[model samples]
Target: MANRTTRIDPAMIDRLADMAYLDRNPAAVRKRVEGMEHLLERLFVIPGINRPVGLDVILDLIPVVGGTVGAALGAWMAWEARNVGMSKFQMTRMMGNVGLDFLLGLIPFVGAVPDFFFRSNTRNLRIIRKHLDKHHPSTVVIEQ
Candidate 1:
């Protein structure tokens, strides 16, 4: 097979750069962080339920499929971090958090508690916020 070089459109590149810029805007970053927190709440916290169980932990009670689904959702946060220009080190650390959460969460009964507290999505969101704060200070929201 011959080597095929992929051609990228300049306009598309410009559009993506524009999107990255917008993503680093304070308002947009705040919205993204809020969305991540909401997702974390739904997955890790059950409303009015006395237990520490969330949908992800509850889902893990199923079998292999449950863990896979939870991991996929956790990975979404890392993807978002990448989109906003997180460093390779930060991205790797985020992946590690997700991986650790997924692995430990596989332990039948004992896994649930750890999964509830590990909160990889929340961790990844923090990493994204820190990256934005340092590299894209304009994106950091300041509340008086």
Candidate 2:
């Protein structure tokens, strides 16, 4: 029997570390929140009205548990905001948006309508981006 020694790449280790603790970096947090916001609010555009739609609307279309799931996702953004040292007032406003969206989404049949309009995740992402741009200027990326 022959024993083979495998070599591990240092770059791969660094990448793994980076992925493991992405939330610790302001830039990574910003990117993470932005991706989530995109998923929740603007995954695709509707053909006729040219409106962007995403998972928040789709999830809200489900019965009872849908609103709860959507709210939980929004709350996760709030958690990420806290990790970046957002002010309590900002947090309150963010949560309020989430809470309102959740309540509106609780309505039967029409729940998705409010989700389409309100977009709590996008609102929360805006709050996070504003904070990051102010406090961590280097993390700011110019949008083309």
Candidate 3:
């Protein structure tokens, strides 16, 4: 058996530490979370209509390109999760959510309906927030 040595990047650790500091700030954390919510709303939740439909549904109607764009956006969310220092398990789960959403979205007309209801971005955001809450409690503020 051979022993392998791994090198850690100090700069990367410093960057993550800075992000952790930002996460600890309640206002900053709230702003970030709110921004994510707004994005999900724009993508998944339709306005002025009681039905559950949004840009993701409308865009996916365009066939290949639309679904691809949506999937790319979902992948960006997963990448953001990684930037926030989420565990590999958590990141993998986030990626799975996006992957499933993308695959299901490729199914012709029926795909649009699922895209509207699945809300993968929102789901991933929830997972990110949960991870922050558990591992970085300082980021969450409990109002009395």
Q: What are the Cα lDDT values of the candidates?
A: 0.72, 0.91, 0.72
TM-score of each: 0.67, 0.85, 0.67
User: What TM-score does candidate 2 reach?
Assistant: 0.85
RMSD of each: 6.8, 2.9, 9.3
Query: In candidate 1, which residue pairs clash?
Result: none
Location of the lowest summed lDDT over 10 successive residues in candidate 2:
18-27
lDDT of 1 by residue, 54-96 (tens): 5667756766677777788778767767766677999899889
Best by TM-score: 2
How should the candidates be ordered by TM-score, best one leading? 2, 1, 3
Tens-digit lDDT string for candidate 2 (25-143): 89988988898998889999999999999988998998769889989999999998998899999999999999999999999769999789888998899899999999999999999
Please give, for residues 51-140, the per-residue lDDT of candidate 3 as tens digits. 544556776787777788877877776766665677899888888887887788888778887877787877887897887788778777
